[model samples]
Target: MALIESQSDAIICINETLMDDELRSILEKLENEKDKEIFGLVCKRWLHLQSTERKKLAARAGPHMLSKMAARFTRLVELDLSQSTSRSFYPGVTDSDLSVIANGFKCLRVLSLHNCKGITDVGMLAIGNGLSLLQSLDVSYCRKLTDKGLSAVAEGCHDLHVLHLAGCRFVTDGSLKSLSKNCRNLEQLGLLGCSNITDIGLISLANGCQQIKFLDISKCSNVGDAGVSSISKASSSCLKTLKLLDCYKIGDESILSLATSCKDLETLIIGGCRDISDMSIKSLASECKKDLKNLRMDWCLNISDSSLSCILDQCRNLESLDIGCCEWVTDAAFQVIGTGEIGLSLKVLKVSNCPKITVTGIAILLDKCNYLEYLDVRSCPHITKGGCDEAGLQFPEYLKVNFTGNVVEPDVFL
Candidate 1:
């Protein structure tokens, strides 16, 4: 009799545990997608709840599959259909597929269509007309996109916060003017490889979108000091990250203006800007010392030990530093970096192609930077493969060291 009573008690406990509130709590705790799927398979109610609650999905599918996905996940807020892989044989997503998505996913706030070559202005127009709540959009490397599609999006999605148009070669000032007229809430804008964009377009963007916090104009060859200076003046207090890589026309004047205006500046990438010298760097160190974290000045031939030393002494919160190809930077800068509390915070250090940095400097840096994760000393004239191998033995297991070349010894059979 007691055994039967115990069995009844166990069954009652199991029934109580599978109650609606308890099951929903279990579903909320599940972090893995596979686990959630398995949980939903337990009952019909679970399946219905999971379908209604799912908010994000990433899929590689055709028009029919996208239609099915939209029908099922109607509450989805984020969707990633990026065909970034080089699969030329597969027919990419088309305008009709985008039309299906826009009509179905009305609550979408983030959409990424990176490298979807088949999509053109027609698809963009559909998205603009439907996904009015979209705040972030990435169409990078969509080479067919001209100013018309982007203008349509800018007009409709006025709440856009992030827009990445990298490698959209056909985009011109007309798109920028449209964005200026709308998209007042734009915070992050990436125009990398948009060679047609000049100072005039940038001036319009800066004047209109004064709340921008992050901007990447890398490889925009037409951008000069005037455009950058305008951005610095307009988004002075809001700007945090600025990437001017390969913008040959950017000189000390624009950098000085940024240092004086953008007090909250954190990450600055000036690689390939050969015109920038120690003067601008020193001023930057003095003005944005507290907030400056990640700085890359690779190929800036004029920055020497003095500028490096100033950064090491002032920017205590710096985490990643890349001074590759700075011909004048020597062991003196490393020595200064190793002596103080600054080195403790550094996680990534790249001194590649610096002829003056030797094995001694590397040893000094490794000894102090206990948490260093990535060290790139490739092509340094004074650093040998043997020395790097020796240093690797002493470094933490997580640390990655990139040496000059791959030298594999031949197998010897005696």
Candidate 2:
């Protein structure tokens, strides 16, 4: 057999399993002024194929950034095109662009199109039309996506595990109901800012899904306590992490219900629920704090010393706590925390904006909570020089601190 003549660059690429498109972009970037002028004359298929596939290149490439991709990489496993700036940068490829990406990435396992404004139902349909191997999909901030698009995802992507639809306003309860019907294996579901989803949809979620481990319904304004209450009744053993921030419709009853039901929950974020008072959280602490490790009650103004007392006294396993803006909690909040054996597990504490807490308060925490690692005390305006001096007495051998929004760096205690 006669040996084939080849360019030096071509010889190296074949050994590396490199694609033609990726190689071409590098060549174009490296080519000199003279080679570019006469490079098109090198071969027939070379120049003809390059310029003719401009539309396809424009579909998945930045306008200013050179796209070398002529065909999708068949073995492509992960595709992340988050943010509208990158998606829109290429003067986005419309429906045809999506078809190209979808048809090309048939082996794609993870696809993230976070805030890709150019993608419509046309782009989503392309996924159904091609990629069946998708396991994780984040379509958060894709404002143009409608329920029709989500319906397609639910229908086609049955193996999806992680689905983030944050800020996808068009998604209604119907979309969630469909997801509950189809994606039974879903492990992580983030529906933040999905305003149309109410108890009707959430109830469907509980009925259809049994494997849910992480669920975020923050900014789901339509969801009331009744919806959460229903979830609380479900004896699902795997519900561990749940975030309900800005779920304005939920009152104290719903939170109480959830605390009662989700007994195994390790992390619970109920920030911005103005309707919740100490009574609600006290009940939660009483019921779930035994297993609770992380709790964020930030901006929960109604929480006072009694509620903090209940949590600090009962939730001994708490590793993280955010009691920001709960002004009613005075220095006395740490009184129970100083109990050597009871509150010993504290590791992370955020008491930002709690003006009532002074040096005496932090001194109790610094002395008792030996494992404290991360602390955020932004604008507590009350943590004066006296408080800093008290905090200086900390026994934190493995601690990092953020005090009053001023970085003292990670001062490890001996």
Candidate 3:
């Protein structure tokens, strides 16, 4: 009976294929995987067509299954083999698996191997040699990668636009130089925790990759004012999002340059940049007021209520603000925010560790910013657990309040 059913399905698929255009239209309309799978189960012809037309795939298998996947997903353009959150006990994809992928998926544009620790320079070499048409590559946390492998990629994949090497500790200035010379079209670059990269490498990058829009160099301690100033001037028109978190060497000079040049800046994160003062903050607020939306200056010790008030007054579209650890920030800043147009658009606010901010300030912000979804007032010396619990009663059900150290978990009396 099973054999008869299979033969009947095959006959039906053959008849359906007679009208090839109609069958292709039906296949294109299927957006859900389950629907596509059911359509494929009809027969060998349907399954073959489905596989050939597929464009993206996320595989969790190892080297042994790669060849079979390559044969099946012949037209795949995006492949994600990231094992960052995987729970499987098996060893992850290695150099051999990447070689198979590079050889098979000639048309592939985006490849992500995030946290694939087993892969090393050998795998990157294979990718550079074979995947010349690649546009976006993310090897974040692949600690085994170094300058040689990344240079090969830069030289080979000239069309590369987005490259994320976050936590690639072994990568140094050499790789940045290679990228600067070859990948001129690169727009977004993430070098989070790439400690060895200094101002020299950044200068090289600024001279070449002038079209960069989004850049994250967080925790790059070697980067200083000169490097940032170069990037600001070079990519001024296109620069939008910039993160300089924990870069102690960065001071007001870098921020001033950015404020003067990058007028279209949207998101600016300088958390832990203790030297940033009201001077640069006020300049930034005045220049990029129209486009600035997300601003995080936590631990910016020099910023006072003057800067905060200036930001609230100028940056009308600001959505998320983090002033945690800004000891100089007082209730006056919240007063300005609550009474102004900024609160109408504000969504997320963090004032943790600000001893000057009390329950009154919190009340004013909550009452005015109806759209606020997340509020963090943790460790604020003036905010009491009972006061926060009472305030929580008035908070919207969707609003998340983080009162970690100051408040206990409220219970039901029923």
Candidate 4:
């Protein structure tokens, strides 16, 4: 008999068809959510089994339904109630909803409340006080959260390792101090757009969380050379990824410190750091060349052809590179990348807004970077639709070219 012939028939026979524990275990191993959803619809027993076995759930529905969610999914290990989409404009998860989650999901290890506008300091306090087993928490873009809430989290969630507070503008040095003092095992921290964080906070964090492996201090205007130097000295051995995007106050001194100290850095983003020049690029190429895989220096106005050449020559393991908006970059840099071993492993390259780049450079790039999958040449005046079409014809079918801001026709071989 067909499995989905009728609801009543399927319900009556589901147990007979899927009776063995081995069969149930095999069905439970299906990882796709859509597959699990289909499996759940087979019968009431299947629905109950699926709900109880589910370890991860992304609740995009309204906050009022969280109680129902708790009643349905009792074994959730990771719960994300973040209203990351436009649905956040309407009232989403609130403090009361968070309280229900904190009380219900005792096994919760990862929780994300990112962009949940209704979530306030009270919600965070509930999460901290209740979810002692929480390890990774992302409350990024929760503009209403303040130091009081963060301090409570630090005090309660001692096992918290990954914390993302990007765009929490009100968080000050005091909050960082509290986090550093309490969350000693914190390994990943993101403080992007927290403008008030300065040398004092960073130093405190570095001194306390020496095991930190990833850090994003992007757009923290108050964090300068002194702060970065302290962090590099403390986390150099363990730090694997560091993003200093738009931190205009930091100059070559900070880069020098990082290049000299952080030997294990695999990913680095200095996007919009206007002060970065060849000096630091050369130092990074010499220091962490083999380890570095992803590098972004978008809008770094000072970088020139020499710096690009140095990077391509030394960083042989690079998988992705972005030097978008660097006006000084020319065809010469592209030539350096396309001709050498640098292009073999490079999968993504973005050179948008560079007026000096042309069709000749791009053609060479397409020829050399056999594995390149994504290329963005937006706003490069010299790169025309015809040139891109020619490159598309020559390159593999998997290549995705971004020709925005260029005079290209609709559906032009994307």
Candidate 5:
């Protein structure tokens, strides 16, 4: 009788716990999509609750199938119909499908059609006309989208805050100018791999979108220092993240001007900007390094050990740093980093192709950076496999060290 009573009490306790509103709210706020999906499968009540509470949805289903499912989620705020896998078993989402989505999800603020190769200006037009409240849209790898479709979006979604047009090669300055004029509240804009975008388009965006916070002009070869200068002047205070990767035309003069103005910057990626030297980095460190969390300077050949010193001195809160293929990075730079306050905050470090960084410097770094979670030492010929294995043993279970191609013998000792 006692055991039966105890079992009943246990069941009742679980029921009470599951019914807790606070717990349910916490579960609803989960960042990971997979975890939330799994949580939805607990029971019919959970499934229904999760389905209704979910604001964002990314399903493999096509437009026709999604339209059927859309009716179930009356509160859907975001939708992603992009191909999630490298190879899709079904046909990619199309313009007719976007029309269906436009009809169903009226409350949607964000939509992503990344790699939906079949979608063109017609789909964008449908989206523009239907989703008036849309603030964020990503059409990355939708190579067919041109100024006509983008113009439609600008006219329709006047409240747009974020827009990604990566790999949309056909989009020109006209589309940018149109969006700038219409979507004045734009905060984040990505033009990655949009090679045709020139200074005129950049200037237009800067003049109109004063609230811009995140900007990625990577691979926009025609946009030089003049373009960056214009942008810096307009969105200096609001700008938080900037990516100039493969913008080979950009040099220290433009970078310095940006760094001096945008003091609130948190993440800066200047990979392949060969013209950036220690001067630009030092300037950046002096102005924004305190607040900066992530810095990637991959393949910037001009940046030497002094640049690292400048970073370590003031950029104490930095969480992730990548200086891969910076051949000038030596033991002196690592020595400073190993002993500095960065040791406490740095979680990820990439030093690949830095041949001068020896095992001794790495050992010091390992000893100091207790919170280090990832270390990439690939192509660093000086770091032996035996040394890396020893370091791996020293590191906690959570830390991952990549020492590929350095292995000489399987059983070699340091």
Candidate 6:
């Protein structure tokens, strides 16, 4: 009878412990996605009971699709599970599951869930509200990104340095102001293809982020000369690399401003900007001059023979120059470059689709540019055996030379 009484007492103790657990869940109920996942496995009863709350479990498990990590999820600092190679799409998770993860991962500093099509702004806000200590976030290519997600970023992560929102179609300048004012320490920022971002936001960014080192606003059609000017003036001391590719609205004024202000610029890309002319090109060449190395002005319609020559003369430190599809430049332009008087430091030169230039121009380049590593003079009807022989004879030590056919074809000049 005593043994039976002892067993009854043990059952009572078990029930009491569960009651205590229920009370804890109610009082200090952290909606942590990770914690719920762990709590779900405390016993067989809990495991089955939490099966109904699989969505909650996943939030704690992180954005990663890995199966079960209750022990390790509590100590995580950063989570980046961008693209997956999944064959089966699970049905337990909704767009709201991300919110649970954010709540659970409170101490998280960096988070990258780029291209996660399932998550929405609500999920992002949940993270912003939960993980207030975030320092870096990369939500690039998330098509549903709107002011809701951006507002959360402003509300939470204040010490962010890197923010990449490439391909997020809904981002505009209004949220950008909030981001600039709040994230006072941002450094590397990428807004590639964010067409909605206007000049006002660019100005705000320039004014706010005094320490920006790398900025990519490529394909932002709204960003014009005024935007460029703001960036140039604001990022003078800190800006190092700038990409203005496909910014068709930007013209000579922007180039001029960037050249004059960004003195320490190393790489500058103005690909497909049709309105830039000799004056702007000259300004950049003279300002950064030897300091500039990589430059791409491919398909710039306003570029003329005089400006290209001036660039070659002044920017002697140019390692790569892409003047492809510049119709105004003639074979004479190549003659000056090939003559070896202007492009001594040139390693890669692309004058492709400039039909006016002939073999004579290329031959001169091969002779003069002894340090040439890559040369593209494709589609110039005049290019023949003469230019190839000259390049082969002069720069035999330099490898990776491509002048035989097109820019894509790799030829070993050495």
Backbone clash count for every predicted candidate, in the order shown: 0, 2, 0, 0, 0, 5
The Cα local distance difference test for each model comes to 0.85, 0.73, 0.87, 0.84, 0.83, 0.72
Q: Output the lDDT of residue 1, model 1.
A: 8
lDDT of 1 by residue, 1-414 (tens): 011225446533333446667766877899999998987776667776687678889888877888888878878999998885666436787899889989989999999988888889999999889999999999998889999999999999999999999989999988888888899899999899999999999999987999989898999999999999999999998999999989999999988998899988989989999999899999998898899888988999999999998898788788888898998988888667656554547788888899999888888777777778888888998897687677674667877787853532111100
TM-score ranking, high to low: 3, 1, 4, 5, 2, 6
Per-candidate TM equals: 0.88, 0.76, 0.91, 0.84, 0.82, 0.73
Query: Which one wins on lDDT?
Result: 3
Clashes of 5: 0
**Which is the better candidate, 2 or 4, if ranked by TM-score?**
4
For model 5, the stretches where C-alpha displacement exceeds 4 angstroms are 1-54, 60-74, 338-344, 387-396, 405-414
Over 161-212, each residue of candidate 6 has an lDDT whose tens digit, in order, gives 8888888889999767877788888888888999999898989877777777
lDDT score, candidate 4, position 403: 82
lDDT of 6: 0.72
lDDT of 4 at 414: 14
lDDT for residue 255 in candidate 3, whole number 0-100: 90
Candidate 1 vs 5: which has more TM-score: 1
Top of the candidates by TM-score: 3
Q: What is the lDDT of residue 219 in candidate 6?
A: 93
Clashing pairs in 2: 21-68, 63-90
